[model samples]
Target: MTVTDFDFICQILRQRSGLVLGNDKAYLLESRLLPVARKYKLASFEDLVRLIRVKSDEAVIKDVVEAMTTNESFFFRDTKPFDQFKQIVLPTLMAARPNKQIRIWSAAASSGQECYSLAMILSEMAAQLSGWKIEILGTDLSTEILDRAREGIYSQFEAQRGLPINLLVKYFTQVGDRWQINQKIRSMVQYKEFNLLNDPRSLGKFDVVFCRNVLIYFDQPTKAKILNNIAGLMPNDGYLFLGGAETVLGITDKFQLLAGQRGVYGLTTGQAAPATKPAAPGALRA
Candidate 1:
C-alpha cells in the first residue's frame, strides 16, 4: 500500500474507534479492512479511502469500527478475577449493603460469555444473595453479537474451550453437537446494543463494570475519555475491572488500583480507599 492510503486508514480508524495506527500497523489495516473493501466491491484500499473521504457515509464508518474490534473472550476467562469477586467483592458487598441490590455491567460482553459466566458465579451463590435484587446487563456495539448472546447457543468447541467440565455438565445441555446455556443462567443476564462514545445517561449506574482487553486497541486519549465516562456512571465505591495488563495509574486518576489484584481496582469516594490495588498482575488471557 502507498503511504497516502495507509495514512488515510490510520486517520479513519483513529477517528472512529480511537485505535492508533502506526505505519508498521499497515498490515493490520489490510487484514481488518479487506473484507469491508471486498463487500463494497472496491478494487483497492485507495478506492475505499476515496469513498470514505468524499462520501462520509455512516454505514462505512460503522463497518470500519466493527471490522477492527477484537472480539476474543470466554466464560470465566483467566479464573482469578471471578475467584476474587466471589471471595472478596461479594462478601464485602453482602455485609456492607446487607439488603440492597447489586448491579453489574459487562461493557464489552462479546458473544455473551463473560456475562453468563458471571450469572453462573452468582447463581451458585444465590442462597447468600436472597432478598437482594441481583442484575447483570451485558452490552456490546454489535447487534448481531447481541442477538447470538440472547439466543444463548454455543458450538461444542466454543463451549468446551474455557468452561470447566463440571460447570459444563450442570449448566449446559447438548443440542446436537452444540451446547445451549441453561434457561436459568440465560434469564439472569440482559443484553443490549451500546456505543461507548455515545452518551450513557440511559445506562443507569453500575456497581461493577467489566471492560477488559478492549481498551488496549484504543489510543491514550480515547482510553482516558472512556475511563472517565465509565467512572461517571459508577458510584464512588464501585469496582472497575480492566484487562490484566491495563492499568488506571497512568491513564486516569479517577480510579485507584486495588492492591494484590492485578486487573481489579477500587473507586475511592474521598481520601479513603476500600482496598489496596494489586501490586503484581498475574498473567491473564482474555
Candidate 2:
C-alpha cells in the first residue's frame, strides 16, 4: 500500500465506518485483510489497495471494510448482562409496552453472532412470549460480513468461543468441520447494511438496542454523533446497552446513566416523547 493510496482508503473508511486508521496501522491492515486478498484472488495487499483506489471497486471496498470491522463476540458473551436482560429488562419492557411487541436492533452485528445469541435467548422464553410481536434487526456497515451473517454458519473453533455445550448441541448441527446454526434460530433475525453516520430515520424504533464493542474506533465527535443518533431511534423509556468499557456520560448528555450500571443507559422518562434536545449537535461535536 503506497502512502497516498493508504491515506485515501483510510479517509474513506473513517468517513463510512468511523474506523480510525493511521499510517502505523498498515501492518494491521495487512494482517487482517490478507485473507480477504487471498479470497478475492489478489496477489498481494498492494494489489488489493491498488484495485480499491484505481477502480473504486465497490466489491473490493466492501471486502476491505468487512475485513477491518471487529467481530469479537460469542453466545452469552457477558453472563451477567444476559441475566440482567432476562430478569429485569424484558419484564420492564413487557410492562411498559403492553402490546408485548418488542423491536431490537444490534447496531454493529458482525457476522450475526450477537443478534442470533439474543434470538436464542428470546426463543427459550418463547412460551411466555407467545402473544408478542418480536423483531430482531441486525445491521452492519460491511456487505461481506452481512452475507456471512445471513448464512448463519460457524466453525467448531468459532462456536467454541463463548457458546455453552448444551446450547451448542441443541441449536447446531455438525456439517463437515463447521457448526451450523439451526435454520429456526437463523430465521429469527433480519440482517441489513446500515451506516450509523448516515440518516437512521427509516430503520424504525427499538425497545432495546445492542451496540457493543464498536464505539472505541470512532473519534469523540463521531462517537457522540453515533450515540445521539442511536438514542433518537430508541423509545423514550427504551434501553441502550454499550460495550462494558463504553459510556454515555462525558460523551453525550442525551442518555441518562442507569441507576446502578456503568454501560447501561436509558432516555429520560419523557425525553423520547416528541423529544427535542439542546438543538442536537453535529456528529463530531455531539
TM-score for candidate 1: 0.88
Candidate 1 global CA lDDT score? 0.80
Tens digits of per-residue lDDT, candidate 1, 147-179, equal 889988999878987788878888999999889
Local distance difference test, each candidate:
0.80, 0.79
**Best candidate, TM-score-wise?**
1
Compared with the true structure, model 2 gives a TM-score of 0.87
Clashing pairs in 2: 221-284
lDDT of 2 at 273: 25
Model 2 scores worst on lDDT over the 10 consecutive residues at 277-286
